[model samples]
Target: MPSHVAPTTAEVYRAHLADASTSSDVFAAGLAEEPAAALVNALAGLDDPPTVRLLVTETVAKWLRRDFHLASTAADLLAAETLSLRVADGSFANQMVVTADAVASILSTDEQTAGPATDDPEFVDSMRERCSEAWETAEPFDLRTPPRSRVYETLGDEIDPAVEADYQAMLDAVETTRSNGYRTTDDDRFDEVELVLLAGAKHELQHYDLSRWGEDVGLASKATFSRTKNRLEDQGLLTTEKVPIDIGRPRQRLVLDDRLRDVEAGDLPEAGRDVIDSATE
Candidate 1:
């Protein structure tokens, strides 16, 4: 049987199950992915399974979008999830909180770069609760909508400087970009989920990968993801190649082609419902 914490997203599961024996022998074959064994055990012990699963699902998706979606493979994201999984048990949680300056250091930034790691206990605790949920359910989260961190409630009216600055910048950028006739997938004025998928795939450092784009921009059902991806591929916005790290596998990594980038930059929803409609057909 597939492990409880393994990805339940149809795309991932369908990809894994291409071979009939892949499902039953996944663990023995060393193919068990994130929410690994320990994390699942921890979540299985939690009082509320559904809510915890939802939280972790959102966090994992957001973390992937923010940090790991650019990875050549799923390895980096999986590694981060493994470390964050430590919150499954109280002793480990206490140790991490007491010994570490940031109680939820693992929740935010990854190993390489420095960023504002969360210190708020309530936020961290909420992360822990979400982590428990991810381990329990093991599904991909829709990252189109970001979850609130509750930092404002924890620290009175004043927002964290980083957050405050970001809020102002976003507001300013909206006016500037809107006036300049620039619109992005994140702007919410567009309908094609593909635009949001593209935005999520892009990294701050001019990097991108399409490993989880379909799931993160998901709607209605997994079939929609597959169909949309297929149409986008046909439109020459998405291409595929052998995995750079695991070249022997049947898996083909999705690449962002120049066509989509050009379209995204040229006009705001100029492609219109026709782009999405053709995909549905």
Candidate 2:
């Protein structure tokens, strides 16, 4: 579920899909109009991408490469998981939606998969009629998806290439440079909290998701993770803000401080540091 209260985001998205005529163009445009709806539709039968990404230990982005089959052997799905880690926000959601739409479109007219199995009695019956010659003469495609370099690169194959390229060029390349450029625990052997903060600073947006790093630091339990975070807050090393979504519970985003970006572990006074104050509350 996207949240505990609301239906999973995918359910809301599936509702929207009802109005959409299984067309890729409609989906592409719908994505532009309602990104959230697409986000919901993306994980489709799955749960909220954001919450799942934050909760799951480290599952691959099976939705990204449109590889829903958990037992897939295609390299694209593996590559998509790697890409998920690098892209900001929810790029994987888009990949899922696009791939599903494409598959639906292809399947609707496919012969082998369409025959008597479907009540329509049209299993790609038109495939030979439509592309027999084209199939024989068709050139082999590079067989690739868009890259992550730009929106066009991510969406080139799915949408009108010209439209994507036109919009892509106009996007401003703003650099989100923090004054605390090298914010880290400067050679200090840090406890879980300090280490988590350091790792967050290295992230693209500096937002820490516990599921992504909890096990690595031995803070797999949310209660412990929260306590550690609170300890860091007491030290003024991190700040947190909650983002409310329609589905699941609001997510608390952890922001590391730039001023104290690089604190030498040994330089700090180790006086009374073991107190935990309501980090999980």
Model 2: residue 68 alpha-carbon error in angstroms: 37
lDDT of 2 by residue, 46-162 (tens): 321221111111122223223111112122322343212111222222221222212122111222211011112243233222223322333322212222233234334433344
Looking at candidate 2, the ten consecutive residues that score lowest on lDDT are: 50-59
Give the least accurate 10-residue stretch of model 1, judged by summed lDDT.
22-31
TM-score of 1: 0.24
Deviation in Å, model 2, residue 12 alpha carbon: 65
Provide TM-scores for the models. 0.24, 0.24
RMSD versus native structure for model 2: 20.6
C-alpha lDDT (0 to 100) for residue 42 of candidate 1: 34
Which candidate comes out best when scored by lDDT?
Answer: 2
